[model samples]
Structures are given as structure tokens and as C-alpha cells.
Target: MDVSKEAKESLLVLDKQDGNKVKAVSGIDDAGKLKTVPPRKEHEQDFLKIDKHSNILENFFSNFMRQVKDPTHFEFFKIKTDDVEKVAPVIETMATQKDTASQEMLNEYRVEPSDYHKEQQGYKPIDESRIDWDNLKQFGITREGLEKSNSLEPMLNYQKSPGLHRISATFDNVKVDTDARLAFRETEDGRIALAVHGVRKQPELDRPYFGNNFSAEDKHNLLTTGNLGRVLDMKLPNQEKPIPVFLSVDKLTNELVSVRADKIRIPNEIKGVTLDENQKAELRSGKAVLLDGMTAKSGKEFSAEVQVNADKRGIEFKFPENQRQTQRQENGSEFKIPQKLGGVELSDKQQNSLKDGGTIYIEGLTDRKGQQYNAYVKVNDKEQKLDFYRWNPDKAKEITPDNKSKTQVEVNSNGKTNEATKEQKEPLKQGQTQADEPQQQQNKPRGMKM
Candidate 1:
């Protein structure tokens, strides 16, 4: 009998039932006799594993379930009046896309203290949306004939020393004067802050408005409504897109001081190198190109040089020294090197440096066809541009092995790296091994030996 090793090593086996109960046979001994072992009881096996913590946990769940089963033990909480008052306008606003302004609106526009107090006391509350526009004239607010208020003034403000973290601001003359200045600093939690000098105390005002455009009449309307705030936008060099900036105001001084310009969008595509009309049209929107070729020795004197232009950077690479035979497969046409060829990449620090205006050097990039090249990529934040150049030994800095590490070329922020594995083919030998020798055919075994 042919038995598997696992079957022979099994501790117990089930035997044929003599009546209702099955017999348990222990493993075969050296003499080949089966010994009987008794079956385990439920409490003996399960209760031994239970501990004090498990008992406590079981009792806790049992008590919770028992209490929940009692209808009289139910509990709930009452909703507050203020919360209901707040939620009504939000629901109304969603149903009808108009400002209901609820009680919070009056608070934001700084309604008279007496009126606010009456509203909070649950008496009559003011509703801004319900107010008539014609009655606004009675309150001394004119859209057309309103002149510029001397109450507001502008000043050039700087943070730390002069020239850094600087921006122009408009302040209320009744509170902050032309000599007044404000400085803003960002906290570790990513909040903008304000500090004021040359004022008795900060003015009482609402939060500043962060917007792109506001006419003179718009300013008048906002100021009259007690809704005055800051406005800011940035137009960067070489790019037509204007990014919106958020600013904070000193409520006590009524001075607009700080703006945090954090969100700058780089175009998904930009103007780069173009070859054909199709390529040119694609590149005008900032598309990248994949180059193919191999490194080879040129001339009878055998000077090694890379034949292909792998990137937009104008760098030429040589064979063997910069690139090695790293793999055998090709991922795509752009990745023209064999799977075995090793290439360089940008380090983590180098990538971060690029975002802040720095260059990353890459070398020893070989295509599947055994071509090699070097590249230099420049990062410019102001232009929102990344410029690529071919590696030039004469003009560019020579990268040492320690300075350059292997990385895939990043086409764009959202684009994945054209990465590949490094598995090279061993050169074929001219001679054969003993395994290749043919063996004499032996006569078929006349049957298995007993």
C-alpha cells in the first residue's frame, strides 16, 4: 500500500462503528498495532481557554442586551431651540437658492445691539432677505450718488523686515491711519493670523471678504450694510490665469493685513519642443516625447556615443560607463531600451527642490536597443514651467555615481513613471553541457520489482 507521509504521521483515525458510537484509533505503533484513544468532552476542551477578561466582556454584553430588551429603559435627547433656528434657513436656502439669512445674517451684518438683543431673547428677529430695497434709501445708503468714504485708507505693509511677505492693504481711517501697519503670520495648523500697530485697539467688524471683483457701488453697499471686507487676486508672470488669494482683517483696527496665496494651479499641458505638425499641436499644450536609440562606438578609432535623443534635454550619453545591460523586454516605444538597461531618476529631496526652483540631473539612461543619454530638468515656479535639456559634458555639471541615483522620468504631475525591471540575458556558450548528451534507451522495465 502506497500511503502519503501526512497520512502515516496522523495522530488519530476513525474506525468503523461497532454500533451507534464510532471507535477512535490512535496512530500505528512500530509493531503496526492501532491503540484506542478516548474522545474529549465539550467543557474540558472549551472552558480551559476562557479567562477573567472574557468572562467580564461576556457579562457586560449580556447586561447591555438585557437592559435594551426592557421598553421602559429607553433613552433619548431633546433638540435645542438655537439649533432648530439655525437649520431652518439652511433647508430653505437649499429648496430656494435665495438668502434667507436667518438670525445669523443679522449677527454677521452687525445689526444694532438693541435689535440683536431682542432677537436673541426670542422676540422679533430681523430677516435681511425680507427687507425692501426701496427702504434702503431711508437708511442713508445710495448706490449711484455715494462718494468714496475717507473712513477707508490704503498702506504698504511688510512682514519680518522690509521686502519679504509684503502686500498693500486698505484700512478704516476712523480706526487705523496711514501710519498704521499690519503683519500676518501663518500657524503650524495652516491658519492665517494678523498683528496691528499704531491703533488704540482693534475695531469691531465682521470677517473680511475674499473676492475677485467689487465695484465702487458694491463697496458702498457692503460698507453700509456693515459687511466690508478684503479683496485680493494674484496675476503671475508669463501665465494669464489669475489665482484668487484669501486675506484676513484686524476687526479692532478695521485693517486688511494678511493674504495667504497657497493654491497655485499649473496647467496640465504647456508649450514644449515640436517636431511634426501633429507632435507640435500636442506639444503646444505641454506634452512630453519618448526617444529611442542605442549607444555605440563611432569611427575607426571607436569613440563611444549615444545615438538617440531620449528627452527634450540636449544631453548626449556614452555606452557601458553611463548605462549597463540591465534587462531584455520593452515596455513601450518610448522606453526603447532593453529590459536589462539601467536608467537614473530624481531623488525625493531633488523632486521637492524642483518645486522650489532647482534642477535635477539624470544620467546612464539606456534604451532597449542599448542606447544611452543624460538629462537635466529645470524647475521654475513663477513661470509654472519645467524645462528639459540634454546632458552636455562641457556646459553642464558632471554627475558622480554618488550624486546620481536611478529613477524613471516623470512626464507630468499626474503621469506615472515609465518604469521597467532589470533582468539581463546571459551570453550563449558555444559548447554543450552533460545534460544535453543523449542517453541510451533502456529496455522498458518488465513491471515494478516486487
Candidate 2:
């Protein structure tokens, strides 16, 4: 018996809440990947005639969806049995087509939309004779610029532009900055369809972003190098269970997005450039790296600067030639200064001291050897990341010590105290060598806050 030919894909359903439409589901506990699928009982076959009517069925599902009128997110919702019930009849028709010879298909996308929904949300026809070009003018993207980039045709069509675009549109009215993909998806209904893929902010450790939760270790590794370092089982929006995924920071948007562990297909040769292990690791970490000597589909060799964008949820090619002008524009803008390092949040005094670009000795970091160690850490503004060193650099000033931990390690392990710090009544921390201010000034006397 040939197991490969006999194996079948378990039934996959469109889940409004399953992993937010980025991926699909199989059995009850099947997280993004299909492991074990309990075979459907014999009676269930009558419920679905899967191998037929793909196009017309697409029209039915779209009409059914609008008639129900569920004002919900079509993206990023976890699929549940109840959620699957809404579209199962039409979707079941696609099953035999879905169950392929291989088990590698994981992220199942939407069925091809019907012309009704594609035109105007299943109820109206679109008028494409006139475009409100004022929308593009505010963003500094002229028709000439858009036409030059070959984005106008797709925008005129129902789908969005193929790649994520950098736009300076006024989102907050005060700020015209967001990484979004443009579409004419809802034009017939008088709506602007933009999939906002990225946002501006440092990944905050104190809270959750979207539905993805981060552990102390995940936070530390992400903030330092922008990579989660390992695969994490994270529960997404509307998902009842967690799925295994690798979390990466979008270097351009600073937005957090994850790639399904099984779906992470790193091509052996990207364009014509073959990447080794080190290059792959760098890309996985969400760093913008440059790869040279690649062949484009146009049969031309070119070099590209690339990084993982939250919009694509995969590796995206960035043109290398424009990097210098982009860097110059970005150089004057300071990157957000992170508040925590290795899972420890900085104190006001500690943070204030770093205002002038100083180093602070932080402990509790585990090295690759699994041993706890301490090091001087500071923001490397030039590289736009954290810099760690065993010894302090000459140009960096020292951050003030926290008063709470001051007395914890004042005395040496052998019970001898440092004469300079012994004279101070406030005591000294293990990492601190001197006292610079009075302790009373550090507090505002807030009630029950600590």
C-alpha cells in the first residue's frame, strides 16, 4: 500500500474567526497545521456534493453572506464549527477539489468571489467612469506616479495593488502615515477599501497587540533582535485554540505579524539568489537585508533590499537603488526608544539618565549557555537597535540606580562593603558604583499604586 497516494486532506472550512482568515482549520484541536483528522462519518457525505459547480456556488455564498448581515471582520477571525455552519453548504462543494494529493496545503484562502459581491457587496453595480482623485492627492501620490508604478489598473479593478505601499495619507488627520494596500473593493458602495497592514509604535511589553500574546522570553528576544527566536503556539483573534507560529516584527511598520510554521516556505533560490543559513536567520528575525546578484522574471540580474512586511506575511523585495534616499529621509527621524530590556522595565531615573544616550548595567539575562549574566546595555541609535557589551564604552554616561534594589547587593559576597557606597544611607545596588541623588525625590507619594 502506498501511503502517500492514499493520504487525504481533512475537510477545511472557511472560518470567520479561525486565525483571522490568514489560515484555516481542520479538526477541533487542529491548530494551523493538520495533524490528525477524524474521518467524517458516512452520513455526512449526503450533506455535501463537493466536486462540482465552483463558480455559481461562489455567487450563492456571497449573496448568503450579505443577506445574513453580519458586521464582522472577514480577516483574522478564528473558524469555529458554528462559524463554519454559515457557509458549509456552499463550501462543501469545494472539498473534493480542496483535498489534494499532498498534505502541505495549510493556509486556505477565500473562494473566488462572485461578480455580484465583486461589483458592489452582492447588491449593486460599480460606476468606474469617475474616480475621486482627491484621495490620491493628499497622499502625494499623483496619477502619474501611480501609473508609473503600474498600480492604477488593479485599483481600477476590484482587487488591491499587488504590493504594500508607503503612503502619507492623513489617518489621524494629524499624521498621514500608514503602510496600506489600496483597492477599489467597495467603490460601488461608496467606501474606500484599504487594508491597513502596519501601524506605528514600539511593540509594548505591558499589553497585547491584536490577539497575539507574548511571554517574557518572547518579548525580550523580539525587542532586542525583532525575532521571537522560536516557534510559539499563539491563539489568534476568534480562535478557540492556539496555533504554532513564528512571530516576527515588521521592520518597516513595527507591527507584529506571524507566519504559520508549516507555511513558511523559504524558496531555495529567491529570484536567482541562493541564501545560506545565516541569511535565512536574518530574514526570519525581521531585519532589512540586501541580497545581490539575482535574476528577475524579466531576465535581468538585479540586487534587492528585502525584509518581512506584516502586509504580505512573507519576505518582500525592496529595491536597493532607492535605499539611500529613503535612509536620508529616515535618518533625522529617531526610532522609538524601547522601555524594557531582557524583560525588565526601566525606572524613570534609569530612563531619564539614558536620555543623553548612556549605558545601564542590566542583570538577569540568560546567555546561550543557559547561565545568568549581566552586561551594560544602551540604544545604538546608528544601527537603530540595542547594543550590549561586557564593559562600558568611554562616551556613555551611567544610568542612576533604582533605590528599591540599592540595598539588595550593597555588601560583597565575602561581607566586605565598598567604602565609597558604605557612607551613603540609601545603600547601593550590585550594579551601581556611586550615588548621584536623594531618594525622596524619586517618589510622588501616590496611594496604593506600588
Q: How far in Å is the alpha carbon of 201 misplaced in model 1?
A: 62
TM-score on alpha carbons, each prediction: 0.16, 0.29
**Highest lDDT among the candidates is held by which one?**
2
What is the alpha-carbon lDDT of model 2 when measured against the actual structure?
Answer: 0.48
Report the C-alpha lDDT of model 2 over 280-343, residue by residue, as the tens digit.
7766655556888765433445666666544355566654444533432332214444566545
List the candidate 2 regions with Cα displacement exceeding 4 Å: 1-142, 148-192, 196-201, 210-212, 232-234, 243-246, 259-263, 268-312, 315-450
Predicted structure 1, TM vs. truth: 0.16
Worst 10 residues of 2 by lDDT: 46-55
Error of 2 at 94 (Å): 34
Write down the TM-score for model 2: 0.29
